[model samples]
Structure formats: C-alpha cells, structure tokens
Target: MKLQVVLVLCAAFALSLQAPSSQECWCELQSEEKAFPHAKLSMVERNVSDCNRNVTPKKTLELESLVLGLDRRIALLHRDISVLEKEDDGELYGVLSLYVVENEMVEIQQMMDKLNRTMKGDQHLTADVTQQLTELQAEMGEMETFDTMELVKGRLATQLLKKDLDNCRKSLNATVPPTQPPQGTCPHGQLVNVTGPQVFTGGEYPGSYLYGAWGRDPEPEPGKENWYWLVMMTVSNRYSNYVRLYSSLSALIVGKSVPGNIIIHSSNPTTNTIQGPNNVLYRGALYYNCYNQLDVCRFNLTTNTVSSFELPKGTRYNSKGNFCNLDECYPYTDLDLATDESGVWVTYTTNQDFGNLVLSKVEEGEPPRLGQTWHTAVYKQALTNTFMACGVLYGTRFVSKDVEEIFYALDTVTGKERFNVGIFMNKMAPNIQALNYSPVDRMLHAYSNSNMVSYKVWFE
Candidate 1:
C-alpha cells in the first residue's frame, strides 16, 4: 500500500511538471500576439509624423481620431489580462504538486521573473512613448498659437495700409482745380469779385492785414505787387503788423479783427507798448503757452470769439547756431501755429544743445492749457536750419548723417501740429520756401524765392 501511495505521488508530481510546459506555451503565444499591437503602435507613430509633415487639417483630424480608437482597444486588452489573472482552475493544481511540482515551481518562478522583467520593460517603453507624444502635442499647440497671432497681426497691418491708401486717394481727387468760374468774369488787373475768403498775394501794413504778407519779389517795391497775403494771423501793425493781404498784382494791408494772436512783445523801437490789441475777434481768449513765450489761442469761428487753448513751449530760435548751409543757421525757427477741427497743435525745436524735436497740443476749454507733449531726441552735431513757407512750416534735420527734410501743419489757435496732411517735399527741392493751400482746390502750392518755378502738390 505504501509503495502504491508513493508511486501515485510520483506520478502526480510528473503531471505537475508537464502542466507548466503547456501553460508556458500559451503565455508565450499570447506575448507574441501582444508584440504585434506594439509593432502596430510604432507604425502608427511613424504615420502620425508623416501626416504632420504632409497632411491637411481635415486629414490630420481623421488620423488623430484613429489614434484615439487604438488607445481604447489597448485599454480593453489590459482589462482582459486582469480578468484572466483572477480565475482559478483544477488543472493548475497539478502544476503546483511537489517533486515534479518542485521542478515545475522553479520553472514557473523563472517564467514569472522573466515575465515581470518583460512587463517592466514594456511599462518603461510605454512611459517613454507617452512622454514623447505629450511633448509633441505641446509643441504643436505652441506652433498653432504662434500661427494664429501672426494671422491676426497680418490682417491688422493690411487694414491699416488700406486706410492709408484711401486717404491718399481722397487727397489726390481733391487737388484738381475747377474748370471754369461764374458766368461773368472780372478783368485780371481789377479786384475780381472778392471771392469767398480768397487768399491772394499783396502788401505790408502791419495792423491793416490780419494775415502776414510775404515778398513776391526778392526786393519788394513800394507798390509793385511785391507782396501777398500768404496766411492769416491775429496781430497787425501799421507798418510791420503780423497780418497782410495779397492779390496777383500786389499785396495790401487790410485791417481786420484777427482771431488768435497772443502778443509776446510790442515795443515802439524805443518805448514799445505791450498792451493787447483792442476790439480783437479773439480778445481775452484762453490759451496755453508754447515754446518760448508763444501761446496758442482758440476761438469759435461761428461766434467770432476765442475760447481756451494749450500749446508746446521751450522751442526758441537761436541766432548763433550751426548751419545746414551758409545761408541757413541753427535754431532755424521757433514754434509756428496750426489748427484742425478738434483743437490747436504746435511744433517747435530746441536749441542745438538740447537736441530735441517737440510737439504739443491744447485742449478746448475756458482757460486754455497745454495738453500732451511729445519730444524726439536728435543728434546735436547733425542740427540744421529750418523755415516757414506759405504758412506751412518745413524743416531740415540730419538722419543717419544725411540731411532729411520734414514738414508740419500748424494749429492756428494752439500752435500745435496737425499730424495728418503734413508732408516733406525734400525730393522736390531744398531751396523751396513759399507754400499755400487752396481750400476749394485742395492743392498745395509751393515756390522758390528767386525762381519763377511753382509747383502744385497733390497726393500720388
């Protein structure tokens, strides 16, 4: 009986050893199958890279959806393996019996160890792949963000360019002169029907002319049509007032109530009287001080009275300054006046030592005061001379060691600058001085002092 029992135990042990071989065969087959999915995953990674390189947005989206589906399938496979590990079977009992069981146990232990190592290796590989994918996705997201921002900026730039182009077109269209005048025309020499606020060339009587006069001839004669009213100003003097009138033949002094002039100095060569102009259209108006003692005066055109204003201050003309040419000297000129529908603006230059270009504005109110002030630094050594022409101010300054000319529109009330419509005409010439704007024709007229050459400027 004892021998039979021992024999039975021995047989049982042998069966246990054989069972593991079968189990191992199955595990190996499953592992091999699992490797197919891993290989497919690798191929998928390659395909993703290729798609990223060559596919359109629609195709890329499709491929990403496929990848997500693959991920779901992989998760289901892991779930299956977890379920199998939880099951128990009697056949597995034979695999655990002693002698053959011992041998089988050692083999199974070795297999388990190897399986653990393989699983650990797989986990490491999965972690590495997941990290790589995450990084790639983040990089792609950043690229998309950059692309979006660039698109917006490009659109904004295009819009701005379009607006500027439209403005240029409008300016050009307005420059064309009228073809004919009213049916009945007056003789050229005689005062033509005193046109609506017409601007003409005429003479030099300080107080009589509200707008100043410029000499039409190099050497003006007493009554030889040598001067003209280029612009309107608020001050006037009997002989050297700030305003004057002009016609084609000659300039004359016409007394009018000037609207926006703040007199800084008034002396009679010896005992000059500094009292303000009496019964002026813009008298007692509020204004802001600009460069030097110059101030900007605002007035209501409808009421024929002044309001309040502000302007830039500190710009002054220096007699002993560097020269662009022998004829042009430094501290070219001080603040000139300009006005727009909104308020007043001024542009001025500091002395060569300060090396700055200044612009200022005045707000509309009871007491005129300066508003925002802006300044640009300039090179002292490159300073050049400047001048005012046809009531429009123009100047020359050095840019990159080359003389660059600039132009500005003045605010008649505030002495600030009008940012729009101001242009630099250097390409036209350097010696140009006279400038005039025709309201009806919207043309900018420019001329040289000594030459008969005249230019009509319109936007291109």
Candidate 2:
C-alpha cells in the first residue's frame, strides 16, 4: 500500500511538470509592458504631428466635449466636498466621511491630471475652447484640496496647461494650412492694402520715388554699390502698374523681366493690395507680399523667377472690413516678414486669437513652415508696421505722421515685451506703411506714400 501511494505521488508530480490540464493559468495574470496592439505608440505620435499641422472640426469638437465633461465632474465633486466640511459635527462618522472625501479628491485629481496632459499642448483649441479652458483653470485655482496644491502655491498644473493651450492655439491658428489656401491664384484679389496713402511720384516728391529698399547703406564704391531699391511711378488714381529697381550708387536697374532690360512689369490687378508693404531681401531673393493670405512671393535675382511660400494665417486677413480692438479699428496689414541677426521672422494676427500678435521664425523651403513662436499681448491692429532688428521684434504705431514711435519691442531670447525703448520718430512721412531696420548700419528704413526714407536711430 505504501509503494502504491509512492507511485501515485510520483505520477501526480510528473503530471504537474507537464502543461496544466486546467484552462486557468498564472501566466495570463502577469503584466505586459506593451498592452496595446498594432504599434499604438507610433500611431499616437503621428497623430500628434498631424494635429499640430492641421486640425479637423470633428476632432476639435470631440476634445471640447471631453474637457467640458471633466470640468462639470470636477465642479460637482468640489461642491460636495465643500458641503461635507461645512456640515461636519466633530463625530467619528463625520471624520470617516472626511476621509472618504479625501479619497474622492485624490481620484478626481488623477483624472484631472490626465485630462490636462491630453489637452494642454493640443493645437486644436478655438476661441470658444480657449474661453472654456480659461474658466476651468480659474475654477481649479480657487479650489484648495491637496497639500501639493499649497506647497506649489495655487494650481501649478492648471497654470502650465493654460499657458501650453494658449501657445498651441495661437501658433496653430496663425496660418492657413498648406492644404487649405488656393494655389496658382490669390483668393482675396490683391495681396496688399492701399488705403493708407497714395504714393506720389512727381507732384511734391519730384525725383525717382523710392517705395522700398533693402541692403546696407550706400558707401562710396567704384562700381559695386550693391544696395537695391524699388522705385515706383504713380499712374492712376487707384493703381500703379509700373515698378522700377535701381542700384543706390549706380542708379542702374537690378531687376529685369526682359532679356536685356532692367524692369519687371508687375501689377496688383485687384482691389486688395499687398498685405504688408514691409519686404526683405535675403541672399539674392526678394520676399514680398503675394496676397491677402500669409503667402509671400519670392523673386529671385539670378533667375528672375517668382515663386511663393505660404506662411501662417494672419489675423483679419479675410475680414470684410477692418479689425476693431478695445481702442480703435485699423486696416489689417495683417502679415509682416522681417530679417534680423538670427534669420527671418513673420509677425501676424489671427481673428480667432482676439487679434493678438503671433511671431514665428520662418524656415525656408519649397513651402515654408513656422519654427519657434512667441505670442504677444499687443494687438496687431494696434501697430501700423512691425520689423525685426538685431534679433528683436519692434512694432511701430502711427499716432500721426510726426508722431510715429517704437511703441513695443519683443525680445526673442526671453520672450518679453518692453515699452521703454524710448526711441521716438520725428517728422515721419505721411501715412507711412512699412518700417524695416538694417543691422548693418542700425538705420531704420521707412516706406511711406511711394517714398523711401532712412532715419538715424541712436541708442543711448
């Protein structure tokens, strides 16, 4: 019988060494690092890139719905906690209820943290969505529940999320996506605005009137004074069809459409003019406004070929009338591209962003893309023109012709705005539309009425 029992025990041990006969297994309960199927992490990363580039209304609505639900739930929980604390009667049951409240608060905080992470850096938020986020942040700030909240002082997570949301929305809304705006032709007639003042060629200003200039100040040279100028002649009451180019020292046209000639025939051909008169000459190409959109026409000096790069959407570019802020309304010269020590930068406003200025570093290619961006508190409509000098963005407002001033300057390094530049403009041309600064000589160039003038800027 003992021998039989030993044999039975050996048989059972042999069975255990083999695969389990029962369906239930301990291996199934073990955790897996990658629980998701079909390369979910990679797919999520791609989706984030796509969302940044362009946002669909459906996706926007879905996110908004989620945020709204979380907001409502948080509010309700906060109210319940407030009531529980108020009705406390110092009993054991009351203390136990408080413990339960604390547990609920912890759970709610976790959900909030997850929701905030999802929505914070998303670029799909619209003006309405932004308003909702602001309200949610305010509510979170008012609630005091966890020790971490007090240790950090206020709702730090909410504040960071607010900032991320604001920047993402601003940068995303700043441009018409590469896929959206029409190609081959401009959608909004002319690209530039002509309401400021008509450029006069012969009436009071008699010489070859300079509308724009780019490059260094003219120095005494034998034959190679390479500075360029855009000379204009007023043709009719509402339009000018001919624009000339000349070397500042040689007075020879540098732009040629014909094989041997020095002029390129260009016309607005529509009621809308260039978005902003401010233009930049980098390397050997000239970058200027193409249409009401943020698209910039690049005119090559060597090949005389004109190609366009679509820029980010601008504020009030499609507005039927003017943009009105808290102060006064002004015509939208909605997009401005300038050059400084670092490289090129574009400044514009978006209607959905409450007319705030969005500044971005311009990366060049077949189609341009915006790089690091800084959103400013100053309204684009408030400034007549903006330019970058020595890696700083300076905005000018035309109080009057004689009262043009550097109202605001943004430091790109620190992303801070300063109002105390103290440099003032005296006797500025009437209705000046563009202002650009040259780092070569530290002179500010002004384009007004079809006349270009340079001013000496002294830094004390």
Best candidate per lDDT, number? 2
TM-score, cand. 1: 0.30
lDDT of each: 0.37, 0.54
Instruction: List per-candidate RMSD values in Å.
Output: 36.8, 25.6
lDDT string for model 1 (1-460, tens) is 9999999999999999878654443333333222224454465568567545543333333333344333434444455545545646665643443335355445555655655665565566557667767766765554445443377669889999999999999998886654333211212221101111122222233323332213232222345233232332232321122222244422133423223233333432111111111111112121222222334444332343434332333435322222333355322223333332233445455563274555455444565566665554433223332322222333444332211334333322244554333233322224332333332233333322212122222321
Quality of model 2 by C-alpha lDDT: 0.54
lDDT for 416 (candidate 2): 76
Reference-based TM-score of each model:
0.30, 0.46
1-460 per-residue lDDT for model 2 (tens digits): 9999999999999988896678665655664443433354455456556545555544554455455445545666787777777775768667777787788778777777767766764644555456655654554454423243265655687799999999999998896556322211223221111111112222224344433333342221344235544423243312222233444423422233122222233555332233334566665555655544556666555576666766554444533223233344433345566775555677776666677888877776755556778888987666767777656677777665445666687877667797655445543254555566655555666666545556644331
Candidate 2: list runs displaced more than 4 Å: 1-225, 231-243, 249-267, 270-276, 313-315, 318-332
Candidate 1 Cα deviation (angstroms), residue 121 = 81
